[model samples]
Target: MAQTATTGTTVAEVMAELAALEDPRIREVNVRHGDDHGVNLTKLRAVAKRLKTQHELARELWATGDTAARLLALLVCRPKAFERDELDTMLRDARTPKVHDWLVGYVVKKSPHAEALRVAWFADPDPVVASAGWALTTDRVARSPEGLDLPGLLDVIEAQMKDAPDRLQWAMNHCLAQIGIEHAEHRARALEIGERLEVLKDYPTPPGCTSPFAPAWITEMVSRQHTP
Candidate 1:
């Protein structure tokens, strides 16, 4: 791995480090996660720790066309440096659900243009863009829902969730749960919609994990909030 004395680590150095950490078992796991080009999360984190934030380096890494490299790019890219067009490009280029989730959660949601992008993306025809939009909406509702139109969001979920793409459906269901848990005024409506939509009602969850069905998940989260 080449390192500049002044600039620290370059993208090439990080790529070399990632190449060194490649394992067949790790690659198999990554393939199952929808990554055709694989590197383990542990190695990715190790590289990120060593390089820290490097926006320019991230851009270069993204261009290398490796799934792990792109995931690392999302980690290191400066949100402030992102433009809407660039974000759109990244979302389109994301080949896996894991990459799409990270790009939306880690990069797009933190950008200054998040709200505008969220609004535009939710209506987008591309399934990835639409999924990210709902995911962004869920994040906003969970944190600060100052000027958002909650009723409108609920209406959309109720109307479109049934026929939506798999990724978008998951995010929309999550958005419904966030509304029920975070906004007391909308809790009843959100739960009602949850029952009607029955989002993930039959989906299997781990033994100890709460189901992601909005009504159940909302009830659990609200109970926890009041318990302490």
Candidate 2:
């Protein structure tokens, strides 16, 4: 029997530990690491689905175990890429607060999926869930065009905020920041969320170490905000 090695910090060391997984936990942990390192997006998404239903897959997910399932589940749903049922299933089983945020962030970036995303968001029982819902709403507001209905989206988010935790304000506002509101009503809702978050200063983060939104999106949001 091999004893588990205990002192590796680099990703390579981590993979070696995983490959040696006489221990089930170690295997799951390492699979999760591959995701953290640089596995392909579609492959990761496939792994996430298997983890959702299969024990062996779950073992692998747990190996990388760094929230790869959550990240992949969210990535699986994207504009022009995601279908509603898949998104629905992802949200339905995503008990982790961070997974909920990942779903919320993904939904906001998409154009046609808002209503379905709205349904799942409300279904989440956690206050963090509500905040993710609220934040995603802000995104809808941003991309909503001349003919799009802003009032409806605002109505949902505002109603959700009533039940959501105050700590979620920052995430909700950050969602708005991505959208860059245009509709007058949504603009106000975006501002309201932003102001609330700014005042509170404490955003409710989901479980796990990774960020929820895409790297490029963050870069764009920051660049635009900083621009004159």
Tell me the whole-model lDDT of each prediction, alpha carbons only: 0.85, 0.46
lDDT of 1 by residue, 103-196 (tens): 8888888889888889898888887678888888888898888888899999999999978888889989999999999999999999999998
Clashes of each: 0, 14
The runs of at least 3 residues in candidate 2 whose Cα sits more than 4 Å from the true structure, single-residue gaps closed, are: 1-66, 72-86, 106-114, 119-126, 145-163, 166-168, 175-198, 201-228
Q: List runs of model 1 lying over 4 Å from the truth.
A: 1-10
Each prediction's RMSD over C-alphas, in Å, is: 2.1, 11.0
lDDT of 1: 0.85
For model 2 the local lDDT of residue 111 reads 39
Q: Indicate the residue-level lDDT of 179 in model 1.
A: 95
Error of 2 at 57 (Å): 8.0
Per-residue lDDT tens digits of candidate 2, residues 90-172? Answer: 55555555445555565544636666666466446655555555565555555544443455544544455434455364454
